[model samples]
Target: MKTVLFDYGNVVSLPQAPEDVARLASYVTGAEPGFEDRYWEVRLDFDRGSLDPAAYWSHVYGRPMDGAGLDEVVALDVASWSRPNEETVAIVDELAKVGVPMALLSNMPVCVAEGIDTLPFMRPIGPRFYSGRMGLVKPEAEIFHETVAWLGVAPGDLVFVDDRLENVAAAERAGLAAVHFRDAAALREDLKTLLG
Candidate 1:
């Protein structure tokens, strides 16, 4: 009730990396996977430390790519981060002003997450739990439980917002109130109802 954990990417402002994933994907499957989740499915493990980038690229791209080639793909993947939402930023500020602490928990790459930490939107939030740093990812029991432990709050008292239903499900199963965030509006309403 006092602290809310937000998923990064959409909730917090992040830089847009270049997009080579699409180009690679098109070459691989003849159809580009342009969205965040599609690209993320392949990338999340690497970002979360569950898989190495070289191994992942080897499996996905059909061959191992050098660091540069891997970065090209990751840049494109990070670029999928859309522009930040001003309204959400405002709400975060408002919530902070009310003495409600906000923390960021994201399934993000170390490089990308570190880059995001330098941005203005992340300034008010507490130390971000980037999967890379934690060696865990969302929709997984360890990460969710680790987040709860790191926050020092009971799961039942914390609320988690993510864009994935599976993530929401995991959070709920762990005893946290969960919201599958759609947009600033939906997030606004969910926070009001839960935190009101």
Candidate 2:
């Protein structure tokens, strides 16, 4: 069976708002200095599972977090990225109705992943592969290989959809067909062509 791999952040869920990040930065004790720059600086390691939540937050806040502080940061962090793109979600529903195998693969931290798990739209996912869980992130060849292996499908039998061109390119390099998702409308057309 052919399978479609979906990217979580921008493809299915709404992209994080800049204001949201700014709000979270305001709550961080030490984020006054280059808050946005700092967030992205350490984000890769955090998403790759090499840095645990506490360490990742500390790196962002410039101090160790107390239990309550940890909870707050984790909540805010997850909330910032949890908004759903209703249109793309509808597409997921359409695909599921027809039994098109679907799975999720995204670069995310454990806390965020756990929070998103409770969302209604996340229920149809199969064989989810998060960077936090897989220790692999998109645009990396290994992740594509691992995903294909886990799905028990050949690369040609899978289609990967992601918002980032680099990620789409990487999947292509790894031998999987990919769509650079610009919007839900484009995605619907792309999937039709691929699945047809």
TM per candidate comes to 0.77, 0.95
lDDT of 1 at 189: 92
Error of 2 at 114 (Å): 1.0
Query: Least lDDT summed over 10 consecutive residues: which range in candidate 1?
Result: 13-22
Winner by lDDT: 2
In model 1, the runs with Cα more than 4 Å from the true position are: 13-41, 57-64, 67-76
- Number of clashing pairs per prediction, in order: 3, 0
How much does candidate 2 score in TM-score?
Answer: 0.95
What's the CA error at residue 27 for candidate 1, in Å? 11
lDDT of 2 by residue, 1-196 (tens): 6799999998889978988888888996558778877788989899999999889888888888769988988998898888999999999999999999899889998888999888889887777888988898777899899988988889999899999999999999999999999999999999989999
Lowest lDDT 10-residue stretch of candidate 2: 28-37
lDDT of the structure predicted as candidate 1: 0.74
